[model samples]
Target: MFKLLLLCLALLPAFAGAQEDSDWIEYRDAYRQMIWFEKYGKPKQFLQNHFRIRPRDKSVPTDGLRLTLNGKATHVALPLDALGRAVFPFSKAAYDDNAELAVNRKAGQLKSGAWVSIVTRPDGVYAAADLRTACDQLLAYLRYSGEAAGKSCAGVQFSYPKNDVSQVQFHAAGGAVTMLAPKEGPAFSGDAVTTFRVFVYRFAALPETGQVVTSSTPLAIAALLE
Candidate 1:
């Protein structure tokens, strides 16, 4: 009996190391999956908003899932029917700012095991407009503080309305034009039009700050039919 006990104690370190290695492998694979989605998953980006987990041990049910965005407080309670799946709330605010998603494991109330998978959807839009024109108008607005010519805008692609469109600006920096769309804005009115407002910051060369400011003109829905 003494020899048997000695053997078991000697094997404990190996067992612990194996478990740690398994966890590391799982986390590494998950990180790689996220990176792939961010880079090659163009036209459709994924956000790590929702997470689901299927435990290796089936006797345990998920107790809950907690989400942390930039160290913010965000938590979601698991449903009674949540057996192999857990749903979390996606924050548009974090997604727009390109925030990272972090997941925390919960101790199951009913059993002694837990495992989970994370899932998220991409919220991007490809506008039916001329890309060049859109960029031109965007740049012009930033440079001269003027309105963009409607006909010039085309094939404009943007992330979802995580923010208002009116206050966004286009600017040139590091030899490339960049667009800055803020998360929220007060409403603004134009010529006979009540336009929704959003703040846009463009980086461009100006006489003063070497940067230009511009606003996005509202896209007319009626023009789509014509």
Candidate 2:
């Protein structure tokens, strides 16, 4: 368990090496999907792109999973957050060399995808309006890209690390507070892993009266679809 935590939060340059070609999570494919967000000329200030990797089999455990880049000249460990996602490192050097992603503590055949989430604040404080704007931004991008046809931003879900015990709260004006209860839910709406403690703060459930604050940092914050 401790080892898994290390891998989840491992910093850049933590581990680097080559792996078998059979484990090819190709860099080109990741780059293509990731580059769109980088080149997108739309408003997505509140959203960030992450490359997510999960086991193809639902039962496979992903704890302590680590991703690495292996190339003739480029070798490095990609820092993965609690969600088994890494900020898609847009490296020209790795691209030119055609590097591929390798995994440590292999869980089996893996599938990869791109995810959009709200940019996290180190202070763990979120304004009520800011959360709405972030959700709105994601919905706009999804609609603009022809992904969300009639989707509406219902609320936001805050995903925390495994075994999280902190409370998420909505603080209204004059010290009134609403508890954003946490439950064992998937990291995202359709994510493969579903063991994290996710706090859902639906705008409908609570008025946008106050700011939201977390006792612990969230792994990701995603829009709640309506």
RMSD of each: 21.7, 7.2
Task: List model 2 lDDT by residue over 147-223, tens digit each.
Answer: 76666778888888768788899998679888877788776765567678888888878766689999878877888
What is the RMSD of candidate 2?
A: 7.2
* Deviation from truth (RMSD, Å), model 1: 21.7
Question: What TM-score quantifies how close candidate 1 is to the native fold?
Answer: 0.20
TM-scores of the candidates in the order shown: 0.20, 0.84
Worst 10 residues of 1 by lDDT: 1-10
Tens digits of per-residue lDDT, candidate 1, 1-226, equal 0000000111111111122212111222233333332343222211121232333343433345333334133333443222222333345554445443333433221111111111111222222122233344333322232222233322222212333444333433333444554433211111111222333222122111222233433321111000
**Which candidate leads in lDDT?**
2
The TM-score that candidate 2 achieves is: 0.84
- What value does the lDDT take at residue 172 in candidate 2? 86
What's the true lDDT of residue 119 in model 1?
A: 17
- Highest TM-score against the true fold, candidate: 2
